[model samples]
Target: MSNIVIYHNPKCGTSRNTLALIRHAGLEPTVVEYLKTPLGKEELRALVAATGEPVRALLRAKESQATELGLNDPTVSDEALLDAMAAHPILMNRPVVVTPLGTALCRPSERVLELLPVGPLPPFTKEDGEVVNDSGARRA
Candidate 1:
C-alpha cells in the first residue's frame, strides 16, 4: 500500500497537478476520487482533522451547494459541516494530501510538496504555465 493518500478530483487542475508533483517525487500515492466514492461522516471528520485546519476551512465555498445547503454560513456547526461534506463530496476542497509528514489542503497544488518526503523536488510547470523549481519556489 502507498504511504501517501491524495483526495483527488479529476476535473480539478490543482488536483491533477498535485498528483503530478507526487509522481515527480517518485512516490505513487493512493488517489481517492472523492466525488465518485463519497466519504462517510467519520472519514470526513478524520480527513478534516488531519489537515490541521478548522472544519469550515476545508469547505469548497465555490460550489453552489455550499450556499444552497447553508454550509457557507459561519454559524454552521462543525458537525453539520461534516455532514454536508459527507452528503456532497464536492463540498470539500480538492487535493487534500495525507503523507507521513502531514496532511494539507493543496490549494495551490505545490503545497503537496510539504507532505512529500524531505528531499529535492524536481522542477515542475503547472498547466497554467507556472513553474515550480526544485526548492519548491517559482522559477521565472
Candidate 2:
C-alpha cells in the first residue's frame, strides 16, 4: 500500500484535480474508485473519523438521492447519514485524501495540501483559474 490513498471519483472535477495534485506532489497514491469499490459502514466511519469531520459533513447534500431520501434534513442523524452513504456511494463526498499527516475531504481540492508533508506542493491552477502557488497558497 502506498503511504497515501485517495477515495476518488473520476467524474468529479474536484476529485480529478485532487488526484492530479497528489501526483504532481511526487507521490503515487493508491486510488480507490469509491463508486465502484463502495465503502462499507465501518470503512466510512473510519474515514470520517480520520478527517475529524462528522459523518453528515462527509455527505454529498446535493446528490439527487439525498433529497429523495430526505438526507438533507438537519434532523438526520449521523448513523442515518452513514447508512445512506454506505448504501449510495455517491452520497459520500469525493476525493477524501488520507496521508500520514492527516485526512481531508478536499472539497476545494487544495485542502489536500494539509495531508501532505511539509514540502513544495505541486503548482496547479484550479478550474476556476485560481493558481496554487508552490507554498500551497492560492494566487490570482
lDDT values for all models: 0.87, 0.87
* Model 1 RMSD, rounded to 1 decimal: 3.5
Candidate 1 C-alpha lDDT tens digits along 73-140: 78999999999999888998988998888889998898877678755775888989999876643212
**Stretches of model 2 off by over 4 angstroms after superposition:** 136-140
Give a tens-digit lDDT track for model 2, residues 29-137: 9999999999999999999999888888899999999999999999999999999999999999988998888888998888887677645664788767888876643
RMSD for all candidates, in order, please.
Answer: 3.5, 3.4
- Model 2 has a clash total of 0
lDDT of 1 at 72: 76
Show pairs that collide, candidate 2: none
If scored against the real structure, what TM-score would every candidate get? Answer: 0.93, 0.91
Please give the lDDT score for candidate 2.
0.87
Residue pairs with backbone overlap in model 1: none
State residue 70's C-alpha deviation in candidate 2, in Å. Answer: 0.2
Window of ten residues with lowest summed lDDT in model 2: 131-140
